[model samples]
Structure formats: structure tokens, C-alpha cells
Target: MGVSPQQHERESFRADLDGNVRAHALRCAPIAEALSGATRASRIYGIRRFFGYFREAAGAGWVLLGDAGHFKDPAGGRGIGDAFHQAERLADAVGDAIGSDVRLDHAVAEFGRWRYRTYAEYYGLAADLGVAGPIAGIVPRVVRGLHARGRIDGVLNLLSHRASVLDVLTPARVLGATGGHLLRAPGRRHATLGELGRLATTEIRRRNAMRKPVFQSGPAPRPVQQETPEPELSR
Candidate 1:
């Protein structure tokens, strides 16, 4: 994605409500009584959000959580948890810096360096999934890979009511040293929200312009907005 205005807005919206929509869609679906005992369904145009959490070290080794540093798509219900987790990690370092006289600046600088890996992991997952909706192509490979091992096991791992979107997107083997091969074999290894969103939108618009309804079925599914994503049966 070349980063257009509308795409920017869609990404912004996904940070909260829109992200939730994507999260919910990943959930399993149920058969509707009205659908002749069938279960396949599609969810479109719902609010979703993707979240990002971070803190910056202030002067004198003081740290302040940037107000806009946290983001989430209400679609997944994971933002607040992510923010708190970051805060917890930072709190210890902050406390250590304040309570001890052991060269505070050096300790604070070390904290950032040591925490770099964790921060990258958190940010990477959110960045990929946050834009997942707009970049449908990115998901197919990951989702299909999950299918081989039954139920897309790693897609969503919520434990104690905490969501882990990071584990859902990139499996370890695919993301590490082997990732270079993936880049070489592809049409495009990475995708952007703006590009994918515009592609989806343009296709839909073209279909409408041609007066062609994409649905091949006899009728549409009953529109009931659910809190969770459409079930696997629908996919």
C-alpha cells in the first residue's frame, strides 16, 4: 500500500472497533436455521481495531507512557491487556531506576536495549494483524498453514482472558532465517493496508458498477451483529 488518506483512516479505525471485527471473524461460525442447514457465511464492514503499546524514557531517566503510544482494534479485545503488560515490564525498570543510586542513566539505557527484542515482537504482531483486514492476501498463507495442524491452533491463544495476536500471524519457522526464501518465491512478500483495502474496495466497486452481485447463493445471511468473529464453518 502506497499509503493513501482513506487507507490511513481505515487503519486508524481498525485500532479500536475495526480491529475487533477482524478478531471476531476468526472465531468459529454456527449454522443458521434459515440457511437450509448450511454454515458458510461472510462478515463484511464491521468495526475493528489493532493496538500498539510503548513507553519512552524521559530526561533524568524518568519515563512517561506516551498518550498516543497505545492502540488497539476493539474487534480483538486485546489492547488494554497489551498496554498493561508493557506497563508492568516498564514499572520494574522504573522502580529500579528510582530506588537505586547505581548510575541510573546507565541502567535506564540498558533497560531499553534489553527490552528491544520484546518490543519488536509485540509491535511486529500488532502491525501485521492490524492491517490483516485490508491485506487479505497475507492471511491466506498463514491460515492455510494452520489448517494442516487442525483448527488454526496458533491463530488466537487467549489465556486468562488475555489475547495474543502476535502468535497468530507469523509462526516461528516461517519468520526467522527461512523468511528470505519466502521473499524470493513471491509476487509480493509484504503487503500494506492501504494497498489491500483499495484493492478490495476497487473490486467491490467494479462488481457493483457492472451490476454484478458477488454472492452466488440464493440469498444473504441474516444480519445479526455478533461480538465475536464469524465461526470457522463460515470461512
Candidate 2:
């Protein structure tokens, strides 16, 4: 449902309106065919593309939930669902610590950390999906292989936020798909090799980001103070 067309920023604001829309729509064959004979209901309008970003979720006396806390590109269609998830968790965190100022501060601070940890991995994937460029990797080949084997649910689940990144696009699957592509189209061996290198580099960056996230904000978890009960007397 999302298309990351590879058009430059300057070209997006060009004077050739119809030419631009047609070229961009034609990036997907089905979309082009569907709109070929379709009539325009209104003059064309454009939306500026948004890159993903994250920020602090909560602080001392207040807490920000949902998109207020963080936001990502809309390519993954996760906005509504993630908003609901954040709202529900924020409500719970508040409910558990409402009676005490100290507890409330600690709870919301922990909530912020929890929020970051929950979406950190998926955040990179969503941003990648929204990047403006041609799909230059084994993704298409692996998708075709999954289709042939009737095992593409993992990809569907991932888009729906029900699965992890490596659930379906494992290293073994990538290797198998790359080998298959070379066997079928040996002439493009060099191109495929280059694509593989890019894929590896992208993964390395993703892992590095995971280890040291650049967008997250919050202090490390502080241990909660608890009243210790006196040791039970022998009975």
C-alpha cells in the first residue's frame, strides 16, 4: 500500500505536474493500469515525505503518549496501531503509580525506557521501508521464493507488527534466494553480488544502531526503594 518512489526533492516541486504523477504512478504496474482509464476527481495535491524520528516519551511531572512521544514514517502503516499500544501502556503505568509522587516519577521514567526498547528494532525496518530508492537487494527474489512455497505470512505479520524482522527474512533465506537469482539470470551475477554487499552493509548499520541508539532519550533505570520486612522470628 506504500510506494517509495525514487524521485529527487527538486523534481518533486517541478512545473510538469501531470508528467510527474504519471511517472511516479507507473513505478507500480498494477497502480498504473488501474488509473490509466480512471478520471481525476480533483486536481492533484502532493504531500511532503517524512523521515522517521524519535524523542523522549516521558519526564518528571508529565508524560507524552503515542505520536507525541515518537513518530516514524507512515510507510509501515503502523501509526494507528502503535498509538493505541502506547496509550494503553501509558494508562497502565499511570494507574499503578498515581498515588505517590515518587512512584509516579519513577514509573513514567521507566515507561519511557520501555517505549524505546519495545520499538527500537522495528524502527529501523520501518525507516528502511520509507527510504526513497530502488529496491536493490534480494528482497524481491526472496519474496518470490516465499510466494512459491506459500510461506509469506511472516512478511505479512511483520507489516502488521505481529512479527520480528528476522522471522522470515533470515540469512539462510537470503542466501538461498541470491543463489536462485544467479542461477536463473547468470548475466546479472555482478549486480546481484553488489546488491548483497549493500544488504550486508545495511544490516551492519542496523545492528550498530541497535547497540547504540541515536534517537532515544531517558536515563538508565533507577532501582525502586522498598521497605524491608523484619526477618521472621523462628516459630
Best by TM-score: 2
**Top candidate when judged by lDDT against the true structure:** 2
Candidate 1 lDDT at 180 equals 44
How much is 73 displaced in model 2, in angstroms? 2.3
When summed lDDT is taken over every stretch of 10 residues in candidate 2, the lowest stretch is 220-229
| Model 1 weakest 10-residue run by lDDT | 213-222
Cand. 1 Cα-lDDT: 0.43
In model 1, which regions exceed 4 Å deviation? 1-55, 66-77, 94-98, 114-116, 132-134, 150-153, 157-235
**Model 1 over residues 104-216: C-alpha lDDT tens digits?**
66666655554443433344444444453354444555566567778555555532123344445443623431354356555544443344455446445543533421221
RMSD to true structure for each model, in Å: 16.4, 16.2
Off by over 4 Å in 2: 1-45, 49-51, 216-235
